[model samples]
Target: MHIFEGFLPSPWWQVWFAISIPVIMYGIYQMNKLVSQRREIVPLLAVAGAFIFVLSSLKLPSVTGSSSHPTGTGMAAILFGPAVTSVLSVIVLLYQSLFLAHGGLTTLGANVFSMGIAGPFVAYALYKVASKAGMNFYLNVFLATAIADWVTYVVTSLQLALAFPFEGSVFASFKMFALVFATTQVPLAIMEGALTALIMKYVVQVKSDVLVGLNVLTSSAATKLREAME
Candidate 1:
């Protein structure tokens, strides 16, 4: 879901742009490293971006100036990191704004923050945490991906609340915006999680060696994930 053009108002929109610019720059640097050193990673990046574009394009009317949809950043975050995924998201968002007319150019920074930075960071962090906890590999992916989708909406609601506090209450506005998204987002999150897990499982089976060779997965982790998928 994107924050529509001009709905964010003045300093708020500018502030988000300011915050997002540095991250986008860093993400570009990160991606440059891969594009230069590990050219093989480009295909994986394309797949991840495709997942984001295809899944997020499915929109449902949720609130004024916004809509509900599955944010497909999780797999990218899982494959690369949040920073790299942020760059991917900027590309996807820019395309949607220009061609699909789904999100607006004015609100791209806000949309990127919620869907790209915050959400993917949460997913990557959760995946790390779940791995450390000795959780099942696919289950960890499912949980991380699902929770990332939910976190994106929560951050979006917070952004909205900050811009337009209800009766001088940001918390109240946050609650309101969150509730509006909750109806559709909850189920979408589960479906996204399942979908991501399935795709990752297939990758583990087909690309296990490549993942290890690229250091995206350690030999041991790759073996475990492959067996777990089986």
Candidate 2:
């Protein structure tokens, strides 16, 4: 969900900017270094960014003048981790803000935090946990992507509640906002999960080596998947 432009109070937006800047910088540095070492990742990253741009741009109206949509961060987070995903998210958000007017410049940092950093980090953590548990690969992707999409909306609601406490109580506002988003977001998340799962399945079948290179699939897992594909 996008918090929209001018939704946050001035100080709140500034605070988010302060929090996001350092991480974004580090992400840029990391992405540059990684691409330099593994040029093959560049096209994958581009596709990931484009996916995010398209998915997140499709917004459904929600509470407090905000809107809900699929974050599209989970797959990228699983592939490149949250840091690089953050960089890609910011770029997508910026482009949306400029031409699409989906979000706003002042609210960019807050959007980045919720949709980029928080969601992707959670997705990565869940993916690792699912993998370590030896879960089915498709199920792991579904859980990670679905849960991450939901978490992004959760964070956005919290951000809105914080900026505008309802009846002078932030908790109440948070609940209100969360409830509003849940109406549309839940089904959207499920759909995104299914789609992401299919994409992962295709990648595992056709380019298991890419997953192996990203450490998403261990060599043994990649080999097993390739054999299954055969």
Candidate 3:
């Protein structure tokens, strides 16, 4: 969800920008490192960008008298790893801002922090933890998307609260956010989780080569697939 324009007062807005500049620079640095390490990932990044572009453009009705869309960050994170996914998301968000204005320039950093950084990273972390615990892969994928998608909105809602402080009523702001956003977000999370799992399964089976190119499918995973086919 977009933070409405002019939501923040001047001083806090200035602080937000100040904090964000270094984060943006760090993202750029990380992107450059990933490109160097995995030269083939450049094309995949473009593909991921296009996928997110399409996903973000599709709007679903929200209870808040607005619409929202999937960021598709969980899939990206599962594909390229979270560090690279952050950069991927920043690029996609930039493109969306320039073309679609789905998100605003002034609030761009906050959006990046919420949707780009929090969403994919949180999901990937969940996947890793679940995998380590010997949880089923599909279940891990589902939990990843659900938690990430839910947390993204939580972060966004908190940001909105920070940006627009109500008159001495913090709980009021939180209640408003929960009422308006949670209904649509819950269903969207389930959809994103299922979609991510399907896509990942397809890639691991029919398009193992693509995952190899993305540097996501380990040699062991590839070998297991080939052996199973044999």
Candidate 4:
């Protein structure tokens, strides 16, 4: 959920900017280094960015009272890790803030932290854990993506609580926002996870080798998916 233009006040907005910049700088380095070494991955990067744009852009204000849209960061996080996913998220956020008026530049830092950094980091971590556990490929994607989606909103609610605690109780404010967000976010997360998994399945069919090379899919898993498709 976007915080909207100019919604966040002074230090809070600045503080979020402070928190997000260094990581994004690192992400810039990672992205540049990766592109320099393997320009072939450019199209995949575009696809990842497109996923962020399209899925996140479908903003549903509230379903029985919720907040925003599907973050679509999970697939990108799986494809590029949190660092590079952060880069893609900021790009999309910037575009939306400028032209789409979804979020403001002032709140970009906060938005990025929730939708980009925290969410993607969680997704990447869960994806790695599931991969190491030898979980089924699509199932791993589903769980990681869905949990990441929830975590993003959880973080968003936390941010809001921190900024404006209810009666000096951050936890109480967090509960209020989180409960409201959950109404729509729960279903949104599940839908996003399923959609991400479906997209990944098709991607595996056409670009299994590329995914394998990127370590997104184990060679064995890629082969199995290919065989299943055939």
Query: How do the predictions measure up, each by TM-score?
Result: 0.87, 0.88, 0.83, 0.90
Top candidate when judged by TM-score against the true structure: 4
lDDT of 1 by residue, 97-187 (tens): 8877877787999999998999999999999888788888789999999999899889989999999999999999999999987887777
Off by over 4 Å in 1: 39-47, 58-69, 213-216, 228-230
TM-score of model number 1:
0.87
Ranking of predictions according to lDDT? 4, 2, 1, 3
Pairs clashing within candidate 4: none
- Put down candidate 2 lDDT per residue, 83-173, tens digits, no spaces: 9999999999899889888889999999999888889999999999989999988899999999998998899999899999988999999
Candidate 3 lDDT over residue span 1-230, tens digit each:
55544665666556666665666677778888878987886886788789878977876454455466777888777776777777777778778878886676777777777787878888888887777786766667778987888888887887767756679676678768866878778777877777777667666677787767655555676667556656
Candidate 3 residues lying further than 4 Å off, grouped into runs, are 59-68, 212-230
RMSD of each: 3.5, 3.4, 3.2, 2.5
lDDT of each: 0.84, 0.86, 0.74, 0.87
Which has the better TM-score: candidate 2, or candidate 3?
A: 2
Candidate 1 clash pair list:
none
TM-score: which is higher, 1 or 4?
A: 4
| Residue pairs that clash (backbone atoms under 3 angstroms), model 2 | none
